[model samples]
Target: MILEVAVIFLAVLWVVTIAMFMGHTKRQRTLATQQVEADSLRDQRIRELARRLENYQGGTIRMGEELHELRATVAPLPDKITILEQRDPSTLSFAQAARLVTMGASVDELTQSCGLTQAEAQLMTKMHGNG
Candidate 1:
């Protein structure tokens, strides 16, 4: 009968609509879960980068402090060297002459600057020169 066919068709349509709505809701839940995981990963990465930046900043500060200390320690060396140079030429040591030779001073320059004999200057040059 025409009435029975209409009732069955309406029932089938209602069932299909309910099934589609359930599928759509399941997909939405899956997408929400994925979004939550992505956000967590992003937050973790930000924390890691922040930790690394803190360590790098700490290292930079430590190195700066060390450089300042080294500068303070070395500040008086030049004045001491000047005083040594102004003292009596005879007071200059062979160690000073050797340091000059290693700095590429010629034998004559060594003899004049360090008041060494020509033989001593030549020996220092041969012992300490680059070539």
Candidate 2:
């Protein structure tokens, strides 16, 4: 009778140990699956950020190129204005005639000081003289 009781006790103990081990294994598998999903989400987020960064870099480069082109186009304007001022004595005279006319100079004064023709002096006085 004693030997039979001991055998039954050992069998029950083995069964409980096996059940506990199986429960632990199932929980470990669930945790592994959750970790895999988290890693996948993290990788997706990283890829999206990389794509946005690439687009920003591309836009920055394009804007820099446009700015350089704009600078190059405007670089000659000041020099051209200076050249126009230096090359044409008649332009200076016309400007002087216009100024004198605004200051109430007569057509004869415009003709004498600015070397304008009579018709040109009269036209400047008509356009820029005080009303």
Model 1: weakest 10-residue lDDT segment is: 84-93
Report the Cα lDDT for residue 6, model 1: 96
Q: Give the per-residue lDDT digits (tens) of candidate 1, residues 13-131.
A: 99999999999999999999999999999999999999999999999999999999999999999999999788786655889887887888898888888888899888888888853
For residues 1-131, could you state the per-residue lDDT of candidate 2 as single tens digits?
Answer: 99999999999999999999999999999999999999999999999999999999999999999999999999999999898678646544687778888888998888887777899888998889753
> Against the true structure, what is each candidate's TM-score?
0.58, 0.56
* Cα error, candidate 2, residue 77 (Å): 4.1
Superposing every Cα of model 2 onto the true structure, what RMSD results?
A: 6.2
Model 1 off-target regions past 4 Å?
A: 1-11, 92-131
What's the lDDT of the predicted structure labeled candidate 2? 0.88
Q: Judged by TM-score, which candidate is best?
A: 1
lDDT of 2 at 94: 81
